[model samples]
Target: MKLLTNRTRKMDVILIIVGAFIMAVGINLVYEPMDLVTGGFSGLAIIIKYFTKGFIHGGIPIWVSNILLNVPLFLAAFLLKGKKFVGKTLFATAVLSVALYIVPSFDIVYHDLLLASVFGGVIGGIGLGMVFITMASTGGTDMLGMIIHEFIPHYTIAQVIFVIDGAIVLLGAATFGLNKALYSVIAVYITAKVMDGMLEGLKFAKLTYIISDQYEEIAKEIMDKLDRGATGLHATGMYSNDEKKMIFCVVSKKEIIELKNIVGGIDPKAFIIVSDVREVLGEGFIEYKQ
Candidate 1:
């Protein structure tokens, strides 16, 4: 057990290092070159770096601006998520911010708009996705999403993130220009798509509940026809005050449509509820039984 845990820790460290490097390259080479503001602290940095002039510019550099924006987000993470999460996210963000600040001081790179936007989005997306895969976030709107999630459990973290990020982009457009804003949107779109790509195969299992009179037929059909496992849970109808079979099954996203169709055909009036499950460590879904 100790050996396995150590190995996992080592792998996480390696991923963080690589992910941070990719994020830095994207910011310094791609986004910075095109003068495009993205969705996170980096985006805020670009805007602040441009507007503040003379003494203010001299006092607060891009790196400082990034730190300023991230401080609040990091605080939120610490308060909401805990120290470990905040520490990791803050470490990652600091590394990225420092990288973005120092890289330009040493070297110059291509500033072409097309190349910058495409490569920046790709690298940034992959890095961010890697962070998410490790059950951590790089703070910013991600932290805000957690806070919102506490208030609104039904809405997803990603949805809340979108709302916050969209507003930030609009503000950037007003401060910078429409062109910068459009490019930022493109960068955000590409980043989100690539992040999804990175986590594509890590699909979660689904839990389906079907309440219907034809539960036996539906359950049998699901197990026999779809080769899926199911259980007949005892349930009572509140209005009818009568016992019924609640067909309960766990399946992957691929098997869901077939399961739903079978239940629908058997009993069109069936009540179906589906939810995304985090893990299912047993039988057909996982190798190890739990």
Candidate 2:
């Protein structure tokens, strides 16, 4: 148990570093240069840089704004949630700040809003996804979302974060103009999709419930041919008032056709319901990982 915990801790640190570095790269190279404010503290940092350019040299550095903006947030989280909850997030946020400071900025997009938006979205999405997979965040609105969820248990953390990020995007529009804001929206959407895909995985499967009188034969055929397992669930038909045997099975998407054919051949009148499963872990599927 101790070994597993230590291993997980080490892995989280590594992922946070990589995630933070990539996110900073997207900000410094594409988003910052193109003035595409997608949201979060990074977006706010860009606005700070813009507004302070007259007084500050090329505006306050993004890393400075990032750290300063997050200090209050981190304090709040630490007080409300405790160190255990804030520990990983604090580390990730600090790493992100350092990454922002050290990462060399070269305008890879050359002020091309379209290219900037897409590339920024993909890079930020993958980076954020990596951080999220470790159950940590780069602070800013991400931590704010978690704090908000403490008050609103009904909403998931991701949903709350989405709302917060959207508001920040609106702020970006106010600073960077609606044209840039619209393009930023595209980047934000892509980021969300890519992030969701990372966390949920790209693999899809089908779950089916089969009701038939010839359960024994159908189950045998499914096991023999499909090389899959099925379970018999006791169900009662309400109007008919009859006990029914429902076969429950989960199979790859490609196997759905053969499964249907097998059941249809044995019991033409068999009732089957197939549903989409986002992720399945176990034997004959993605093995459970630490």
Model 2 deviation from the true structure expressed as Cα RMSD, one decimal place: 3.8
lDDT of 1: 0.74
Across 1-290, the per-residue lDDT of candidate 2 in tens digits comes to 89978998899899999999999999999988888888889989999999999998899999999988998998999898888768999899999999999998889987789998898999998998889888788999878877898899887566676677788889999988999999998888888777777876645899999999999999999999999999999999999999999999999999999999999999999999999998898999877765
Clashes of each: 0, 0
TM-scores, one per candidate: 0.66, 0.80
Q: Write the per-residue lDDT of candidate 1 for residues 155-247, one digit (tens) a residue.
A: 755556666777778878898789877877877777877776675545578899999988878888998998888898998889989998888
The segments of candidate 2 whose C-alpha lies over 4 angstroms from its true place after superposition are: 201-205, 212-214, 217-229, 235-244, 251-271, 278-290
Q: What is the lDDT of residue 40 in candidate 2?
A: 89
lDDT of each model, Cα atoms only?
Answer: 0.74, 0.89
Best by lDDT: 2
